[model samples]
Target: MLHADLDSFYASVEQRDNPRLLGRPVLVGGGVVLAASYEAKASGVRTPMNVQQALRLCPHAVVVPPRMHAYSAASKAVFEIFRDTTPEVEGISIDEAFLDVGGLWRIAGSPVEIAQRLRARVRAEVGLPISVGIARTKFLAKVASAVSKPDGLLEVPPEGELQFLHPLPVERLWGVGAVTARALHERGIRRIGELAELGEGPLAAAVGPAAGRHLYALSRAQDPRRVDTGRRRRSIGAQRALGRRVRADDEIEAYAHGLADRLGRRLRAARRVCRTVVLRMRFDDFTRATRSHTLPEPTDRDAVLLHAVRTLLTAALPLIHERGLTLIGLSLTNLDDADSMQLTLPLEARADSTLDSTLDALRDRFGSDAVTRAALLHRGTGLTVPMLPD
Candidate 1:
């Protein structure tokens, strides 16, 4: 197994396109640090951080807006390389993927040679740096690639797996988040080797049973997970962060309508239909609530999905008022490919479906702004944050 991940994906793209930005601290996205160059990171600037704080850390960092389309194109190009390298490819995110080369020794040489060639090809063809990790399992390969960053390559042979992993900090283990790391610290378990020595009982008492067992196995490099290429996304959804300001009912409803329309378009584009509509909300207090309604029949139609989402939102209105809503999200789940579904639509339902298809066609040809629901005609269409494919 091999894991291939781009080095500072967004920032690297910015540098690749402009000669002046090379070897400088470049920060992408002012509102949030979407990606920071290695130069910026050395000054303690990190991604998903506030731009103000990042500027304070790296005073001379150059900030740029995010280019989602460019990133999407780069991702497609990288995945094409991945597919060319191996038939079994598992995409982890936009900039990272796992390639299983278990049976390619005869044709592609050893895993190490394969990884070196893959890195060279990406740097040459894409004009971007990629780091790769070769290992016996997917989990270890991912960890290895993360450790070997910014145009580096590393491999862990089967015999040296524990030697490579046990010396690392406990935080490097898969499930050790901040809270878990703090707990491990309190127990004087700073390294993976130390955690492994404590046995499962003590680990379970420290964290819950399931998490402890999981951490214990990973600490000893006992991950049994394979490179899965058939993993399908269980849900498709979109969300908007509304911040702390209070919003009127009409405004919130408009956001809901826009999200439903966007989700409907995505569903149709993927040629899939969903039976369950879920409304996810986050309050000002940072608490979250979810409400779901399963439709009688699956649909990718805008009217059906919008109605179900509106119903869920209406049912949750009292809680939203009490908690002071800050974020609204909608997910369509219980998915089935459109080809597999046979819907019996009534005359009125068929008319609505026809209108939906027509509007989708117009948007695809002209642009997303070509058509808008009457409710969102005046207010600008709510922002649709492009999500990395699952």
Candidate 2:
């Protein structure tokens, strides 16, 4: 098993595209810090922190707005490279994946050689730094990647897994968070080797029973999970945060339409159709409400999904007016393969379908902004941050 993770994905992309930002402290995002370059990190800047605080930490950092489209394109290209390296690839996020290369030893050389080649390929082709960890188990592999970061590689041989793992801090074990670390510290158990000396009963008393047993087993290097690539997503969705800004009904509707358009395209691209359309809303006060409608038939057509979302949005207008919406999102659920779609449709429906296909092709060739709905002409879709992969 090999775990591959891109180092500071969003910030690295910004630096990679602009030579001026290279080797400089870079921060990405506006209201909050989504990613910070290693230079910025060295100055105490961290992701998901307040933008103002990040700047205060690294006053000289170059902050850049996120480009969702570019990130999406890069993620697709990276995943393609991963799949090419090994068929059994499990994508954990936009910039991380797990590749099982155990079966390719004879054909691809040893695991260490494969990992080196994979890292070299990513840097040469994608122009990004990636850290890879190789181990007999997935959990250990993931931990190894973190231990050797920022364009580094490390492998834990089966014969010496314990020797490599014992001296590490207890926090390296799965499920050991700040609270757990503090609890362990109080008990004078700061290392994995020390924790391994405790019995399950003592470990459970320190933490909860389940977490204690889990940690006890993991401290012994007993993770049994595998890299799975056949998992299917339960839903597809997109959302935009509205901060403290109060939005008008028309503006909110336009954003909703935009989310629908993006989600619809994703559904079509995945060759899936959904039966349920759900509308999620958040008010300025931070309270949220959800409304959903299930279609009689699954459909990936943009008009159908957008219309359903609009109906739900219309029904929630009263709440929006009372609470003042600050966020809007759309989700499609209960999906099925597009091949299951009916072979026949009414003449008008078929005509609309043809138009949808044509629009999709044009957008694919020219770009998402090549064509836009009349409603979005005045109020743009707003900034969309690229989300982690499913």
lDDT per model vs. reference: 0.88, 0.88
lDDT string, candidate 2, 1-390, tens digits: 999999999888898899999999999998889899999999998878999999999999998999888787777778888998999998888899999999998999999999999988888888889999999998899999999987799999999899999899999998999999999999999999899999789999999899999999998888999998987788988888777777778878888988998888888878888999999988878888999999988898889998898899999999988988878889899988887676555523334457778888898899787888788896666665555443
Candidate whose TM-score is highest: 1
RMSD values, in order shown: 2.5, 3.6
What TM-score does model 2 achieve against the real structure?
0.84
Compose the digit string of candidate 1's lDDT tens values, residues 37-81: 999999999878999999999999999888777787888888888
Worst 10 residues of 1 by lDDT: 343-352
